[model samples]
Structures are given as C-alpha cells and as structure tokens.
Target: MNKAFKYSYVSDFLNLPEPYSEGELQKGLLRQMKDFILELGGDFLFIDQE
Candidate 1:
C-alpha cells in the first residue's frame, strides 16, 4: 500500500473535496465511474461495487 500510494494520492480530476470520509470518497469515485475506470488504465475493470 505504501509503495503504491507513496504516502499520498491524487484525484483532482474527480473534484472530490478535502477532509472527506471513506464513504464520501467511495461515492465520489463511483459518481465519476467512467473517468476512474479510464484512469485505472486497460488492465483493471469495474465489474461491480458492493
């Protein structure tokens, strides 16, 4: 996790606000599903979210 995130992360494109909760982050990502998927590249896929 440390190697992947490198102690920080970015999602300015998603327009998510700062000091957000886990639920808020998840919802914000889901709201921009297409953009997130594209950002993930062609290797990953969005099958389903629970």
Candidate 2:
C-alpha cells in the first residue's frame, strides 16, 4: 500500500465512535493493540509481569 492509502485507512479507522469509560477505553486499546504497536515502528512492546 501507498502513503495515501495508509493515511486514509488510519483516518477512516479514527472516525469510529469514542469509548465511554475507562474499561471501554482499555477494551478499545486492546482491540487495536497489534496495529497500534506496528504503527509505532516497533518502539513499543507489551511485557507481562508474572
């Protein structure tokens, strides 16, 4: 895909309705977790503390 396509895709995705609460927001983030990390150029990683 090209720059324009990527930009448009993100723009469209961002047009979705906003979340209502902390739980809802967290759920939304979890849903886009992978795509979010990819967009950040691998500078982000989720570490599980056990």
Candidate 3:
C-alpha cells in the first residue's frame, strides 16, 4: 500500500532474513533474542556465538 511505500527505500539497503525459530527451545530462544536486539533499530550491534 502507498501508506508504507514512502519508506520502501529503507528495505533496499537492508537485506535481512526472516526470523528463524526452529529446533529446540534453547536454539529458538537464541534466535529470538538476536532478532529482538537487531530489531531495536539504529546502531545496535551484537555478536553471535557458534
């Protein structure tokens, strides 16, 4: 819709993947936590442990 089209350009530079919450609860929890932190917007950074 045009209502949100004004900001569509923002997505052009931001190529983010969909939220992934699969497997066990602990694995999903980490994904959700990382997703939350990343969604905070503006200069928020985090490191993921493998």
- What is the alpha-carbon lDDT of model 3 when measured against the actual structure? 0.57
Error of 1 at 7 (Å): 2.5
- Give stretches of model 3 more than 4 Å off: 1-23
Where does model 2 exceed 4 Å of error? 1-19, 35-50
* Cα lDDT tens digits for candidate 3, 1-50: 58778665332223334542334444655666788889997688768735
Output the number of the lDDT-best candidate: 1
For residues 1-50, could you state the per-residue lDDT of candidate 2 as single tens digits? 67767755232343346535656555556657756766887678755321
TM-score for each predicted model, relative to the true structure = 0.48, 0.32, 0.44
Candidate 1's C-alpha lDDT?
Answer: 0.77
Best by TM-score: 1
lDDT of all predictions, in order shown?
0.77, 0.55, 0.57
Window of ten residues with lowest summed lDDT in model 1: 1-10
lDDT of 1 by residue, 1-50 (tens): 55877867787866777878888888877868956786888897777764
On a 0 to 100 scale, what is the lDDT of residue 24 in model 3?
Answer: 46
Error of 1 at 42 (Å): 18
